[model samples]
Target: MMEQPLPNPILFHPLKHHLGYLRDFAAQSITWPEPELRKAFQRIGGSQLDLYIGPLPSLQIAEEVILYLQQRHLLTPEPYRQHLVPVGYRLCTLSDGSAWALRWGLHTGRHVHLHPGRYSLHTLRIKANHLKTALAVTIASIKYNQPISLQLLNQVRAEWLELPPVTGYTSAEGLGKVLDLVPGNA
Candidate 1:
């Protein structure tokens, strides 16, 4: 029996619709209505207040839009700050799911990471697992009586991104358990 060839990994690029949404969002003529912004965000799969992280470009665009809106005072700072918590949670979920897929050798091509530079599938997998572990630790600290704060979550995410990639293993179950400890999870 011969091993089957893996399907080509899908190369990811930011979608035109999403880019259009971002452009319209940044345009000065627009009144920056919250409802309209929410609608556009939903259209780009942000309805649940969770960002799409599969494509690196989409995440980058969302970050830029969030920063732009905040800088312009277009969005209420508190609510938007709370929104960052879920975004971090979503990143952990993505990392866990990606690790599982890589572990099974399924859809390797779909695991592309484009930011900072294009990364090979193997490197992407390693980074995903490492991120999951780092985030899990951060959440655990919160669970063990550390106060939950948006500033801390933001710091953890920024630090994780800046850290050199290293190999690590974190089970989906481990991530899921810590995730429940996140604020608003009840």
Candidate 2:
């Protein structure tokens, strides 16, 4: 049997790593609605978030925390609204009209840009739902007795993007994927 080939990262935005930002002609257009989300998001994109790790804490701990949250359905990250590359950067679709990749990082340390959508009212709501879910993951870290490093949280986001969307969910139950922790860059 032959191994399957991996997908290529879109060359259109070679160095772009920001989430929700769309670019064309080398100039960026639009900005994220909630700027703070950028910080949380950037860590997963490529940058590292120092949440107590402070120069070499156990990365294993970081990975564990995020997996725990997902197992409980506390964080059901919306799948990457874009390409299926294995790493670094992807062109995500935020909504119909608006898109903004905060001048930040990438997925699993992967980085890329996004393309705009139709800008319909329904798209807007979906965009909002997407960000809300991402932030919900962040909030869980803050509320957690053992705070989860944003880097790991974003890594979880990276892995989640590789999955199918969690549909027909209830607040009481979480996404159906079993708890399997993806190894970290550590």
Candidate 3:
């Protein structure tokens, strides 16, 4: 008999595991331009870069951004499928084994959500060059006031590569302490 794979793996991505702390850290990094910083904070924190366009611009622009980043190998899609569900829950897989799972809550065309699939951190690690690419994607989406491209992504990715990864945030409090986002000692 062959061994079977576990149905679900553990969540161990340092940044994602303690996303709240990371969000706070990123939010507090900027001081001036309080309003814009606050908005950026919410967008990056929520991992919803679609809001940067004021009123959540068209999904077309977001697709364009995805295309640009994908071409540069900044972000890749994971292999997965969805079961029979409502229209809003459906996703169309691409030729490159990728898919788009957008959320069309009220203002459908105005917002282009990232494929709302629950991807395992382990899969992200082994397949998509680790969480570094996700970080690069987030930075690329945020830094651009207008233009979005592989060149911009590469630049941000290079800067991010310099920052070494710090692991071992087993507890929420511990993560908060290291990020200096919360007011408590864990």
Candidate 4:
């Protein structure tokens, strides 16, 4: 008998809705003004504004999106995927008291527990620079209360990581040049 392929570890609840929303919104960018977004927090049962911002997806809704991206051949190369692995729920925690908790580090995997809005902007800038278009776009969306979409995410992933079986090109810049080859976003 032949061995079967094992299921991906990241396939979990919450990801489905997250990915579904991402795909829908990616077709068009959606903006959530600060007040409306704050109202959404209450609708979702979260009590504070800080609970909703981060590089990683919401703990309750990321796996599905990541897995869908992987299944659709939309994920970046192994290195980038590997970096994303430790970023999910394993890196996050809800504090029993007070209004703060820990978030995982992208590079170090270290748990830096602190209050929200207390991180380094310089590091965020570095990450945005490295990730290319999507990062800046997402940050802008977040700042302006916008919803992001999958096409845009796909565009960004293509820029940062190659489709498997790596060939010509090494970074987002190369990907951007190649994108010009196609007539439309596709």
User: What does each candidate score in C-alpha RMSD?
Assistant: 20.9, 19.8, 17.8, 18.2
- The C-alpha TM-scores of every prediction are 0.19, 0.18, 0.28, 0.18
- Name the lDDT value of residue 38 in candidate 4: 29
- Ordered from best to worst TM-score, the candidate numbers read 3, 1, 2, 4
**Alpha-carbon local distance difference test for all models:** 0.30, 0.28, 0.32, 0.31
Question: How many residue pairs in model 4 have overlapping backbones?
Answer: 8
Least accurate 10 contiguous residues by lDDT in model 3: 48-57
Off by over 4 Å in 1: 1-116, 119-126, 146-186
Model 1 C-alpha lDDT per residue in residues 10-98, reported as the tens digit of each score: 22222212222222233321344434433332332311111222333344433443354456553443443344454321111222232
Superposition error at 144 for model 3 (Å): 20
Error of 2 at 89 (Å): 18
Highest TM-score, which number?
A: 3
| Candidate 3 structure quality by residue, lDDT tens digits, 71-173 | 6553322211122125544443433333334443233232223432344221121212223333343434444442324454355434544333433333244
Model 4 TM-score?
0.18
lDDT by residue (1-186, candidate 4, tens digit) is 111222333232211112222322322333545344223222322121222223333332234334544565534444434534664322222222112222333433322222223232211111211223333235334444544444544443453232122233433553342222211221
Candidates sorted by lDDT, best first = 3, 4, 1, 2
- In terms of lDDT, the poorest run of 10 residues in model 2 is 177-186
Q: Output the number of the lDDT-best candidate.
A: 3
Residue 22 in candidate 2, Cα distance off native in Å: 18
